[model samples]
Target: MSDEERFVYDGAHVVDPLGDLEEEGEKSAKHNRAKVGSARPSSLLYTYGPGAIMDLPQFTIMPTGLDEWDRIWRRRGPTPPRIHAPRLRDVVRMTLRSPDVQLCPYPWQPKKHSRSPEGNDLGVPSRVFPQWLRCTGCDMLGLLSQFDYRNTHPYRTDLAVFEHAKCTGRAGSGTRKATRRTAIPARYLLACPDGHLDEFPYDLWVHRGQPCAKAELPALKMADRLAGKGASAVIQCASCDMRRPMNEAQGEAGKAKLPQCRGRHPHLDAFEPKGCPNATRLMLVGASNLWFPATYSIIVMPDSPEEKASDLADRVRTALGDKLAKYRDNLDLVRDLLGMGHVDVTELPDHDLELLLQAASVSPDTPAEQEQKLRDWDPVDLLVPEWQHLVRPIVGNRAEEPKSGLTLATRELGPGLRPEITRVLAVERLRKVNALVGFTRIDDMDRVGDLPRRLAPLTRTSRPAWTVATEDRGEGIFLQLDENAVAAWEKRVLDTDVWHSHEEAHRRNFERRFSETAEQVNHKTRLKPPRYWLVHTFAHILIREFALTCGYSAASLSERLYAWPAEGREPSAGLLICTTASDSDGTLGGLVQLSEPSRLQPVVTNALRKAARCSSDPICAMRTPQDPEDFLHGAACHCCVMASETSCERANRFLDRRFLIDLPGSGLGFFRPHG
Candidate 1:
């Protein structure tokens, strides 16, 4: 979906410059107000939760009060609560199984109560965080800590901030006073690279963290200069007669000037007893780098009976409901034993519990037979098993029956593209589950493999045991490339001097961004093989082509690569370009229609033809990876082979059109015309 369609307008965006209007003009004002309120649909409450900063038309808001989940649930007024206790419990179980992951549950405010006869209990919550607001009318910057729960209405916590103080900016009639004004979230926050977030230390910044003999309640003000830059912004302490520029609290030098992290988790209303040693940096609350969610995903394979076993477990859980909670301690043990073999009623020690366990382990094949069936599973790569399942011919097996979630069919390719392309699968329906394991700040996703200390939890409880997750459904086009053809092309490319230059440029870029230590540098030195480059470049071209023909936008479509190293047990190369949405049913059959042989042939031909010559012409085609303007890509740009960051799995890096089509200065094109 387009961002415009998803972006919502909070009521604060529609401010009336003119004060209170006359009685005759009130109708128009009311109509405008209603329109803005409707924009923030209740459905958003299901998608966003605390710590998640939602983009408003004017500013942003982080949904606070996740720590107050119990409080919110008790006071949930007329509108029924959206409860997912079962799903939440399941997610917690999954987190415990994955040792590398930490648990942090996203706030889920269901639209309606599960017990409600009219409501369905399958909805997920929105992940929007609340903000520390600053009132424009009285120029009062209020901290989230100052919010009084006594002022909270039964159902609406949003109104608590307005009750703090009435606006003093405008005059009132007789003994009356100015009306209440809404406050927007503060724009600035203090954070460390270790993912410790806290309120901007206005007092410590101005006082320089020294003991000041000033008034008990000192006044603090944030003034903006005409320059409209961080350097021009200043924070002042009236009592101490002190002031400091925001610029000094930014960048590398700012680390020395700022205070140490206090280890505050505002979203969960908690703090670390042991203070963090890392120095804090001034960061904009809405900065994209502040939150980088690390997610792990796997394609659902048909040949894998574990998929069916999982479904059966879910069915048993649903049937037992509250009764299943009692068996939580033995759930894993029961599941493991069930996977190995069926338990005989006569050999079972506990007769009463046998039925429940048997129901959960209802499978057609016996343990030994299932093991023998999987003996031929010689997967070439991590994704090879999934690719094999996609290409497999589906017949009359109940386990392999076409489900509503994912449906696939293979097709034959024409002679021209056949030598390079091995197989094509049209996916009619597919479901993707993205689990939020942990997050990092300042650092990129490359550091996900590091220790848990380097990552931040989604919730406040130290050493949490569960994390939140969401599922998306969609359609896709899958293609497999010939391993031999890819191997031959890779050998030719690696021998060329141009390939060596590309490798050196990649090395320089890596060292520049990361530490120079041998350990860090060596970890990233596994140079991307020519085969990866060839497949990655082709994926970009295909995505660009699919975006124009398919109804979905380029950003909505994402790529999944299946490639192997130079020396590996299995030699495999393939790509899956798919798009998914938060909605129940994924998308139209546009992508599936394009999977047809007649339709796919033209798309490939046009994409390759366009890649042969970019709009930038000889300059773009002749550019090398060593060029200062082009550090990662060669003979490629936005107008040619580059794609949106959301679409490319490699962050739009390690791509070169020369690998796909012949270029002016290089003869390393893998897809050059045979004639």
Candidate 2:
């Protein structure tokens, strides 16, 4: 016996811990009102009789915080009862309001190795737990803590022994005494709503050998006739003589090792039973508050293309029953459709109209679409202003920029020409000015022009009768001598200090002097020896210096030059020819023969026959007036500068000759030429 039970004295009835317990029992049937001082609402206050005076306070509407009593009442309404809140661990819940987060069906995995001798498909398929049944994170331990199970008990029953049993009721009269007892005095068993066998304890009377039926079973038992026949038999239990079904008797027997009922009273925690797949043995166990409904849905408004979308929506809703039709008058879906150009909103449909109305009653997507449709209604008059600003410049188009009174060509001819110039500039920046300079070299290798021609080389026979040679700083300079040169003239470099830096300034001075000299000589020579020879000579100097510095033999340099280009034209010049010459082995630097091979003759005779169109000035000659040459010579191309500086075969010699690696002031510095 428990310590609490031992406290009961032999003569005393049940003790009353609550002082009003007797009063409560006496007043249980009365619904009478309490005195006016009572805190609870009373029956008197709710009575509708004419003479029943309501002494309660008058109802008054007041601003929320403006009234002190209203504020206090509002604050008190949300406070929980004095009891503490339930903990997540201690909660034994049967129904959940929110949808449970789904976990991946296959969580744990097994390794791919053999374990048993009979290694035949020893792999186990993944076990899937019912979505509503199991706890997510932990192994089942966490789920057990949520329930309060203090009121449940277990019982022992012999199923085979009760297969053939019977019970007979016994009654007693005080004046008359029975000679023999029909059965033991019937004792009542406390019943559990959840079908648990262990909640109540009683005794049974047995006749033949068969299970007996209960005299006072609950409504479900009487109405449903539950319990299948001839499966497992339910006999009146000797301890708790309640008539249980065969399955119930067997389940109790299986758990017979649990604590047995010993005159202790137990109340079930709840009445509902759980049906979880994870449970090992199926038995009746009660769950608290376990009713739930099954399915749900949602609806949204369709997008609108025309203006009367709201009216149309209202009409549709009115035609259908308000409870059955969802009126989607909000504008959010329509706005989204407008932005996307078109949309099909019929794809998502909802059977429940009320749910659809709740979802899209105030949509933001449709309102914006309606606003835009109104704003862009007219499309014909959009571009009138732009055309007005552009008419004047189109009529006076010219080739070059004008200056001073000549109108200075407004920087660029017009807007249309600027784009082409920009495109050309962009190409130059990407490929470098060497793009123009390397034209002849590429042409020679790829056969770029219509006619193929060759230039004469200056051999022993081609040497003039009289040649003037001047030695300056270990470098030999050669010039053709003629009688017209009467003035003792000297070429001098001026403006040596006008550069960004001292070295750059000096380098510029050197190039300027060389280029100026070459230009002057070009003007003097002109058509006499041919323009091809001028380019060839300049190209030869660059190639020579480049090859010599890079450690190439003179013969190899000559061969490379000869293969590159023989004759080509540039934008400013015509049918240019070139030939190459070099000493065998490494003894002498290579040279390109620029003139025809003919025996030396008188200076005057040589000058006349080779006489280009010369003027009064001996330094001046008839330069081939411009030609419509579609291609450019390699020597004059700025692209060649970038190519030679970067990947040209003659880069070293060209750099040695002090040639600029890139075009200067050409606005194409970003480009690097590729070979």
Using lDDT, give the best candidate's number.
Answer: 1
Clash statistics: count for each candidate = 21, 34
- Who wins the TM-score comparison? 1
Task: Give the per-residue lDDT digits (tens) of candidate 1, residues 552-612.
Answer: 8888788888776555446668889888775445788888788888888888888888889
- Per-candidate local distance difference test: 0.58, 0.20
Tell me the TM-score of each prediction against the true structure.
0.72, 0.13
Off by more than 4 A, model 1: 1-50, 56-132, 145-164, 170-179, 211-213, 225-228, 306-382, 393-404, 415-419, 447-451, 460-465, 512-521, 524-526, 617-619, 627-630
lDDT of 1 at 252: 82
Candidate 2 per-residue lDDT over residues 116-144, each given as its tens digit: 22312111111011101111111111111
